[model samples]
Target: MLSDMRALTHRVRLDRRMTWTALLVLAVATLVAIPFDWFGMWVNCLPDGGCQFARNGMLWYWPAASFLAYAAIAVLYVRAARARGLGTRVLPYAITGAVTSLAFPAAWVALDAYFSDHPYPEGPLPYWWFVLDRLVMPWGMIGISLLVLAWLERNPALLAFAAGYLALVLLVLPMGDGFGSPHFGIRLGMALPQLIVGVVLLLGAFGFRRAARRPR
Candidate 1:
């Protein structure tokens, strides 16, 4: 019974930690990513977007969200460690999260350097790289983070949201040609994942708290 109580206590603490994490991710996604790139082309590209086109063309907007995310993550790990009364396994998770978030953008930078002098003729292609690079890659990062968090907490609400978000991504992925379909379809598709995530976190915040407390 003592062991079980400790486990529940730890789980509850995690639920609390992740509840805030969910809110943070959503906030940055809305405030940073949305206002910066209202076109939906660059939606949810990472955990930080500075609410001002924080990605490639406009990285200057990043310091705002970056500070918040890092600070919250620091507080999250500290509180989680204290609550668990154990060594900080959460450190690894936090580091891994940061690495995963940076994976795409970092790779893009390195590859861009290598391909700068490509042999192929380099006129701007009429098509946009938004769907695959900007949309899918960042969404992929967000999805991975969500799934990992859900698995850790074993929270049904988080899992359900993650599943639904991925399904929405798949449904929208093929809407624009190069990926096929109408242009508006592409935009709407791009918009929906971010929108749905925000709505889910808002409506299901309580559900997340309740479900996470159970901590299967």
Candidate 2:
């Protein structure tokens, strides 16, 4: 029985270590990638048509792809931690991420159907839809941030991440293209901070999971 207990303790320790490693990796990745993305360093393409308006522009594709990747990683890591009997506090946050993961496709289809007519309907649907859809990404991030705040009060990285994104959103609102503009579509220069924020939330989710797994 003591041997079995020792083995179980070892497994738990290993799992805890793995959780910490994942959190560190996620945090470092977020910090490293965000600067490159925010400053437009990772891409060789200029904002000029030669790059920005190209058929397959890296600037446009990068953020869209990266956000999706972040969503996937966050959901998977949270679920994995929960399955291992760790980070139960993060389950709701994981569900939020999962829903946000689907928001992209759902928004795409819904927007296509709603805006099929050039003039669109003469109602509040467009306005509300525009506001709600745009809010979905932020909502997911906020959920994760709150979860981190609740569970890992010592680690302020996720809170900082959420705050930075919120600040960016406030800064960009005045400069934002109207609802008629391709604001909903992939616009890297416009959405870089948001993509980075999504990434931070993802990384923070893992960090929160790590904190949750630690023995009191």
lDDT of each: 0.52, 0.46
Q: Per-residue lDDT for 1-115 in model 2, tens only?
A: 9999988865664453233333343344444544443444332334452322221232343345435544554565567667888652344444454455456456555666776
Candidate 2: count the clashes: 0
The residue ranges of model 2 lying beyond 4 angstroms of the native Cα positions read 1-88, 118-133, 137-164, 170-216
Model 2 has an lDDT value of: 0.46
RMSD of each: 8.6, 9.7
Model 2 per-residue lDDT at 188:
44
Please report the candidate that would top TM-score against the real structure.
Answer: 1
Clashing pairs in 2: none
TM-score attained by model 2: 0.39
